[model samples]
Target: MNFPVQQAQGPDRIGQQTAVEQSRAVAEVQAAIYVARQFPRDVGRSRSAMQAACGSMALADKAFYEFPRAGGKVTGSTIHLAKTLAQTWGNIQYGVSEMRRDDEYRQSEMQAWAWDVEANTRHVLTFVVPHAKFVKGKVEALLDLRDIYENNANNGARRLREAIFAVIPDFFIDEAEELCRETLNKGDGKPIEQRVEGAIKVFQQLGINADRLEQKLGRTRDQWSGADIAQLLITHKSLQRREIAVEEAFPQARITGAEITSKNGGGRKQGPPDDDPWAGQPTK
Candidate 1:
């Protein structure tokens, strides 16, 4: 069976794109980016992101193939060896075909080890990575405003707009949150009812079934803390949340929730990746 291979430039051309050329390219982009100070701030972060998007390992077999750009061919063995080479050596040596034939790396135990690492990685991303402290901090700050408005609904209602634009101005998912914030900001402006109702309306527009949000919080939208919205942001892409919206939204896993909780509690940071929904295609 042939596996779908990752598209790679011809191995020969890989040499052409040298460290000097890469550095020059980055310098040029950085020069233009430095024009906006924000770009400079993200320079290191964006580069790391680009690297993560192209990590090691790939499935092998006859059905898979990726064509090279310069009319040069990428042989099947080259593709297979590339996966092992990427993982074992931390880099792909030019003559990978020899390694592919090496029986030492092809043993059943070696394959099992590779898969064990992959499985644990998937487990980690599913249960742990999503609950990042950085995201939680942002959500906490967004909801913290509820405390201020608690003392005086009148002044609290009046100060919402200032809080929104001045404090939590950026959207976590989309503009719906902002719309909800603006609605509360512009209401008869007291007791938070207008803000809550407006948020439900906006969330509905965003395809979130917010009909029960008020009931869940035990207060109409105005009475609920922004923490509810913040929690939504953190777990918006959660398997359970996505499953509620659509059947089979996530791949079925043998791992149980308690298992994930236990395994994740120990701070492992890896797992096998899910299939890319948008493969070799653009997504809006």
Candidate 2:
């Protein structure tokens, strides 16, 4: 028996798939709205929960990031804090999505959205992220799939933070930030000297010496306060997340053989420290 050949339906099939996806998304949003209207959040309870979360030292340490912009430092809450607040606040849906990819441009058009399901308020941001990184003041293409995904995620996270904040109340955010600052200043039950030492060790692993850090803060190590240590921790978190480059954070710091020896105790260079100061601390 001879089999009949079938004609390809490329465009039609893709169109159908796109329609189906759009319909599914619409249905999900409708369902979310319905559920939110049916069971609205308690404002008092949500505020209390968010305040308690912000009171965590570990969470507060990673909540904010600072980066230099136009001769001044810009500081703001990070995606980690936004997500935590969204969860604690309840009745919210937020996420980042890649809407389209342009191989020719080496970029992806993305959207970050936050929907206040209870209040029916929504915030959406549409932007593009280049699949490239700055290395030594040069733009370098990200060839690896993992690298591309990470780059998108890092850029998406910043936008997502903004979207979530736009939906949440500004007063709530302000109060939470104040609580976080208070928590950071309280020192996590550890002595100030020990906390400072741990922080210095952490930065040393990143090829930054205590002197460079002191220079960045314009203070001596002995004169550093809990607030200063908190700032350093935030900067350290930013460096780890690649939100800011090492050179940008510590412009004067240069890795030399002597510095490497000091970090490694005059031994071979190794990986990051296995013992994290905030290891046992709760993130949220």
Question: What TM-score does candidate 2 get on C-alpha atoms?
Answer: 0.78
lDDT of each: 0.32, 0.86
Question: Model 1, 134: alpha-carbon shift in Å?
Answer: 26
- Backbone clashes, each candidate: 12, 0
- Least accurate stretch of 10 residues (summed lDDT) in model 1? 122-131
The candidate that achieves the highest TM-score relative to the unseen native structure: 2
- Tell how far residue 61 is off in model 2, in angstroms: 1.8
On residues 217-258, what C-alpha lDDT tens digit does candidate 2 reach at each position? Answer: 899899999899888988998898777888788885445655
Cα displacement (angstroms), candidate 2, residue 49, comes to: 0.7
